[model samples]
Target: LPDIEGELCRIERVRDVLVRRESELRYMMDDIQLCKEITRLKKELQKLVSIPDKDKLKEDREQEEELLLQINKLVETRDFLVDDAEFERLREREEDREMAASLQSKIPKALAVQGESDHESVI
Candidate 1:
């Protein structure tokens, strides 16, 4: 009887650990989803830095040289901006800011709803 009770206690302890682990897994899954979302946004933002020349302006010698310099600079910046790690950082930061802003915006509305519910309960 004592061994069986000890085994049951051990099983319950394992069950508790499993439940806590499951909750932690769920949170990690959310983080993974957030990372995935950040990746997609980074891809989208990188797409904005297109590698195409769309200007069809004719230029004098000085103007053409200036144009070329500007184009080169843009190309270099685009190259740097399109990096995976850079994009990932930018996307994650932007997502965090957006999430914060949304939470801020919801606060007032949530307060209003809570107030309404409280008033209704009193009535």
Candidate 2:
């Protein structure tokens, strides 16, 4: 029973690691999906993998430069998107800050004064 419990704990740890790895992969996939070129490269790579002939490999080698160029373009696109997303986040933060400042300004000073007076009366 003790050995079984230890094995179960190990399995649970492995499952946790696998879950985290899967989530990381999902995030990577989502990121890749933003670039159409990477998707095309992936499809080509899959096709290459499926074809198990030396002749096909030689022919595929001819397109390697094109594939790499597309991959690099995709990388550049991803970098631009990351920057755009950061910019959008900062914009949202600024908007939220402005809203909070506006709300704070509108919160009645008269109510604050009345609350102070009430507190004095209670004392």
Candidate 3:
């Protein structure tokens, strides 16, 4: 007759080993899921931190543009003032030259008139 009791014991031992291996595999799979969750959370954190940096960069760009606009306005104003001063200087120089010419012509006519009066008194 076969030893049925021993055979049954041997089969139970094999079943127990399979069940333990399955438990270990389940634990390992749970760990893998936990690792994936941690990685996703880390990525989310990085994005949150970078959002402020992006906003700051946008603000800096706007400020730089404003400064450039101010600089351009100052340059234009300087150019206008310089042009006005140059035009005024030229006009004043032209007026002085005209006044000198008029004075010189009047002086010669007055000298001629004086000489004629003297010659008639001597005769």
Candidate number of the best lDDT: 2
In candidate 1, position 20 carries an lDDT of 58
**lDDT per residue (tens digit) for residues 1-123 in model 2:** 856975985797678667656755755675768666688797886676666566576667657656767778788878876776567557756866886686577567656887999999999
TM-score of 3: 0.48
> Residue 122 CA error for candidate 2 (Å)?
19
TM-score between model 2 and native: 0.49
Stretch of 10 with least lDDT, candidate 2:
19-28
The alpha-carbon lDDT assigned to residue 8 of candidate 1 equals: 89
Q: Candidate 3: misplaced stretches above 4 Å?
A: 1-56, 120-123
- Prediction 2 global C-alpha lDDT: 0.71
As for lDDT, the candidate ahead, 1 or 3, is: 3
**Please, what is the whole-model Cα lDDT of each candidate in the order they appear?**
0.60, 0.71, 0.62
Candidate 1 yields a Cα-based lDDT of 0.60
RMSD of candidate 2 to true structure, Å? 15.4
